[model samples]
Target: MSKTAEEVKRIEEPYVCSKKERLGHALGVLGHDGANTMRGYTMPFLTDILQLPAPFLMILTTLGQVLDAFTDISMGVIADRTRSKWGRFRPWVLRAGPLFCIFMALSFLKLPIGVVGMCAFAGFMYIATGSFAFTAVDIPFWSLPAAMTSNTKERSEIIGGTTTCSSMIIGLTGIVVPLALSAFGKFEWTSYFFTAAIIAVFAICMYLTSFKLVREHVVPDDSVKFSLKLGLKSIFTNQPLLCVQIANVFFLLSIILRSYLNYYYCTYNLGNLSLAAVLSTINTIGMVSGALLFTIFSKRIGKRNCLFISALVCLTSNLVLYFSGWSNVILLFTCAAITTVAIGFGYVCVNAMIADTIEYGEWKTGQRNEAMITSTRCFVTKCVGALASVLVLSSISLTGFVPQATEQTLGALNGFHIMYSLLPAITMVLAATPMFFYKLTEKRHAEIMVELAARKEKKENK
Candidate 1:
């Protein structure tokens, strides 16, 4: 337990995961992100396809996010304490696949074309799935990694696999969804419905394989009882956790806002909506590459340093994009690709760092509330995601942009650039600032793991 380098080096071997666990974990994350990719269309789908007002769409999405903020932790607390033969978190993860598939498909269904009926029906379905049903799966799903293994490299592999898989799915979604819609000859309910069915089936298969074969190595103590106040308060006491949450909010805000604006950037700025697919594919490739590269980068430079580097890359790309993207498509794609890659790197670092925080929390707080800890992860994502939605709504209203319009005014175009560039530039910097306060180094985390192992061993022997 010394701070000696020799001790740190000798403490753990190079943990080689089996092919089954590695592949299964990757598929599980892919399924989770794919379902979200399908449901996450609430703002874009309603505005683009249904021609709903941004304000109207905003209310539904914001409400869902707000409700989800509260319920996410509640679900985490419940999952953390549950005693089941299948295990605490796995049961929830196992059931989420089919539920989301059904709900996501229904949300995309071409209900009778009346405005009021469509709004109520789709809104309910969207909220039901996004806020309630999906969180049931998401909180526990992310929680599983911390419980699965205490080895830092092994955790990175799990998080890295998830990040890479999710990025690939998102990249493919950008390419796939548009192509699917093109086949229908126009954007309509049919496009979404058919596409959702395919995504749903594949996602279900991914989840089934993950839980059925792959294993979780760390399980929560059955002795820890669930408490609403204790679960809520734990978030504040964990300094490293708080630091991670703050950084995550800003970083994810930048990511989501850029994604929303990319549609407009490609359609109006590039003058061809279909080019969105091309640019998306580029970003996707870049992101997957970045995630892979950062896997090595974090090992060399440390996770916090890698994250700061990611922020710098994103800021530079957005700054370039804002000043010059309107004039050239090549610059736009190149910078966009760079931005996605940076974002992908950041995602991997943060995910792995969060897993470390779970151990840090248990070491310091004497409790490892994986479900609650990971719940904050989801809550920050949704919370910032809500703000990004608002940023879009305000941009739409401020720009005097009309939904389903064939074209937009110059002012509206500038607004898109501001969001796509200036705003994210600011958030990217903010994301990095908090990483400075994150004090959990790799050596420190390894020491914590060794001590925690000794503590557990002492407990079992008694």
Candidate 2:
């Protein structure tokens, strides 16, 4: 047999993980996603329901997210150093879930304070929910996949399964929130508060349940004491993690920019706001499908190839959509669906790739910084999302868009097209660029795991 065939055979060895445990770990994000959905409502709630100034909302959100991104790194360091009986990362989901959800609930309250005071209150809630509370859970929760199992295929399954579950949560919220909003009527502050509270409750329950079910099977060696400098070095020196981070930022940028413009595209360019719902439904379906298919795709083409191909597909679809124009509504929806599926598939690929880097870092640095490496996922996401929102919002303001107007100006329409099609294409090109530099293949990762396992066993016998 060829050496390549032998390596593939060796790495396919099974790792033990029960369905219940996998379910438990996967369930960890229910509350986070639930609360996040409610948080997504904050902008419309503040601007439309509470009638807050756009400038105030802008400054508060942008600042809060930037703060949140920075906090993620620190939280990662803290999680890595944690040595409780409940395990380094699992206990955090239980500890931080309620408080995080509480802040989420509070963010929606219609305070009786004056405009400036209300803005201050909202800012506090925003920062507390995301920067402090969410950061505590996010690093630990994501770090679990690396800790759960060392098997390459199993790790892919775990990450892919979790993403599939998240997409389902998104789909569920997408359906339920609109119905709740319709029943409560438009601009009803009470509706926003009530919905947020319910989501918080649900999130808290899921977090608790996940805490009970998830187990951290892969514990770090106690002999390797925590060093802040070393943890920082581990992150800085890991080329695979850096490449994945840059790629994800641009990938997420394209998705967010297109999403922000969807409403404008439906309302003005397509002359039907209801079609936004159709496109959204397609996007969600695409996400779930891509996530479900990731394990299979990653096995065949490998994770790096999956990332590269997904980005290329997204870029091509967007370019076609841009040049083809929106003459056919059906064609536009098709492109949107295709792009989201690619986005979904690429997201899972990056996460699994990130997990692989944990072992790579350990192999290279002689220190395993799982949470520290995993923290980049949260860091890049928050920072990129916040920055993207600022860019899109600023672009919208410049377009002379008038809310509630029957028609938008030609410039506004053109701007929507650029955001929806052209901008995403550009970002996808950037997203794919980093993939060229991502050199961590599955065979390499498998070899690293073997060497690390041997090192661990030798240390134990001594």
Candidate 3:
């Protein structure tokens, strides 16, 4: 054997996390999911509870997302360059998690001001929660799995477990929030604030606990200094990360629109607001079940196949729901269940694929920007959310949707159907389109890791 081949054969040891650390990571996700569940209700809260105009809320959220785009990149660069005893990602997660929860709860507050004043306050809080607080916490939290382990299987399990755990808790929130609001007399501003406050408290506790429990294992290379130019270069030059972002943009669009429109679908179209909670529970079950199934079958089917299958199932189920109409509640529930299961499967695939790209960036460019790539993911997500908000509210305006009305116009109902079903189906097709160009497979990733391990060892030996 050649000397070079022998030298390259020395692979670095994989860092295996303890069960306690894994649990801590999952707990942090539970906190984040709890806070986001409230954000999902922002559209309904502003429209139904505050009686705000759809167009106004749309414009406000879009502005917030625009600001969010800049913050996401800035936070990513900040996180990558961060150095302390606590490590790059953990300090951000620990410090910013509680702030994220607090800002989120504050966004739902009802003031004595007029509509314009309330709008101004809401916009301020929206920027605070999404652009600043959430940006700091989210970029760091998502970057953790890659920093925690180099072992692909371990990272997959970690991400999968956290996602499943988050889905179940979010599902519980779905069940509980409606009941709480109903008991408190339906969409009251005080009730909304109260619910948001409780979630914020719970989230704070989770973040603090996770800070004490988890630790970062994979230290970043201190040699590669982070600059705006380097960050932009990392994003532009890395092909795999770009492809993942493309897929994520459409995927987020479909998912965010569904979340934003779910309240309208349940309340106006189905004539019962409480049913949204029930559907959330059902989706939670479906997602958890689907994630478990993916864990078992992903190795055999491959991640790309999982993505395509999920898109196919989601697209088909949504279209079927659109054509069948909402008269059949049972059918609606069936389709929702099937679609969420596919979502659960697809969620794991996307996260795992993103984690794999961290190594790919390092191998190809000699600079690993885990948090920067994660920030770009956040950027795509916020931009898509902004676009979805505009589309939903524009449709609302066109349909002449009445805020807090018991009865909606036929056009408004049709709009809900399109937003909930047809739009998502079309976007699902777009979401899966980029993955076809994604060439990084498990076998290829394994080879990259081996090469990276060798390169690192050689650098240290020098």
Candidate 4:
């Protein structure tokens, strides 16, 4: 017999769990995507492998990411309105997972026929198309956690674990990629493609493993209508969600800047491309360790407080890095390590807070739209990323970065330092300011959940 809406709503027992197992499952999904074959590999390829000019490369990458912002949100709406035998988000993840992997692998292929401009165009299109497929899987994958469990502590642990594992995988890639390139005695585009292929395979395996370990709660039919107008309205009307979204925009922008500059810093200033990978690995380790610690602390101090604290730590670390003398690699590493930890700590709380906001929406409007909420998060993230790419590339132009210069002048080196250090530090401080107003406490969340449960029961009885 086909299950009625009431029966589906009644089957809530599947959401229960110990924090550890839930964390593991969440980590699996995050690691699969976060090492992010599309993201971690693509931009570098465009800059280094294709040898596209910085300005043009930035424009293409930014446009593609901006397009993804819209695509991700739209996919979220579709997922929210969807009904499938495998529940709301999981079926989409399962269906899109392999295709995403395939496209990621294909995106690395360089064409022989195209001259510089044509090759650049082809590469940009390939990445943009692959990113679209990625959004199809990513939107719902993130949204699933909101529907997974209502316990705030468990949610924090889950998010924390996921972020930690993802960072670790990313860190491992930093070390592995350079070593692989050196080992193969290759510096041409083929090395880049081969490395991407290896990562793609790993990502696919991890995603399938995650799919097997994780399960989704059935979404109620009472969720919001999946319309563009409605999605925008909901986001604007939800104050707490909006604040978090804004903060995430700044946070992600800072991350993009850091990523774009890290390569420049290593290659030009530090005089070692390999050091970029080592620094990235160290940064990832700091992130993993911080996430684990944050999960422990969140149990005692709560998510909101933890977020505030992490933000403070991040702000302080950035400031320290920005002002310290250029010769101090140890000081820079210390600050970077601190900031990485802050990001790890803050990310878990941010995600849990988003899940909490979903409950708040359900309580107020009697609508559960996990996909839309997740998409809202993605929208802000992508916009920030797009903006950061523009800023990085534009700054490169403004600072007179001569990419082909045999010897980098002192002025060019200084410009790179300022972009890498001072700019991101300033932005991160701004990002931390809005969190003071976020008001979702554990008591408040429990109250909201109770009211939502009552509303569900009333609708079922009717």
Once fitted onto the true fold, the runs of candidate 4 whose alpha carbons sit more than 4 angstroms away are: 1-24, 34-38, 116-127, 182-187, 222-231, 404-406
Q: How far is candidate 4 from the true structure (C-alpha RMSD, Å)?
A: 5.1
Q: Per-residue lDDT of 250-319 in model 2, one digit per residue for the tens?
A: 9888877775555457757898655766776887899888887777778788988888888889989999
Residues 225-322, candidate 3, lDDT per residue (tens digit)?
Answer: 76667667777877887888888888778778887787788888999878988898888898898888889878898888898898999999999999
Task: Give one clash count per candidate, in the order shown.
Answer: 0, 0, 0, 0
Per-residue lDDT over 307-417 for candidate 4, one digit per residue giving the tens place of the 0 to 100 score: 778777877787777678467888878888888888877776777778778876655455666788888877676666667667766766676666635468787777777
Q: Which residue pairs show collisions in model 2?
A: none
lDDT of each: 0.80, 0.79, 0.84, 0.69
Residue 66 Cα positional deviation in candidate 2, in Å, after optimal superposition:
3.7
True-vs-predicted CA distance for residue 303, candidate 1, Å: 0.9
User: Which pairs of residues have clashing backbones in candidate 1?
Assistant: none
RMSD of each: 2.1, 2.7, 2.4, 5.1
User: Which 10-residue window of candidate 4 scores lowest in summed lDDT?
Assistant: 4-13
Q: What's the lDDT for residue 101 in model 4? A: 71
Q: Order the candidates by lDDT, highest first — what do you get?
A: 3, 1, 2, 4
Which clashing pairs does model 4 show? Answer: none
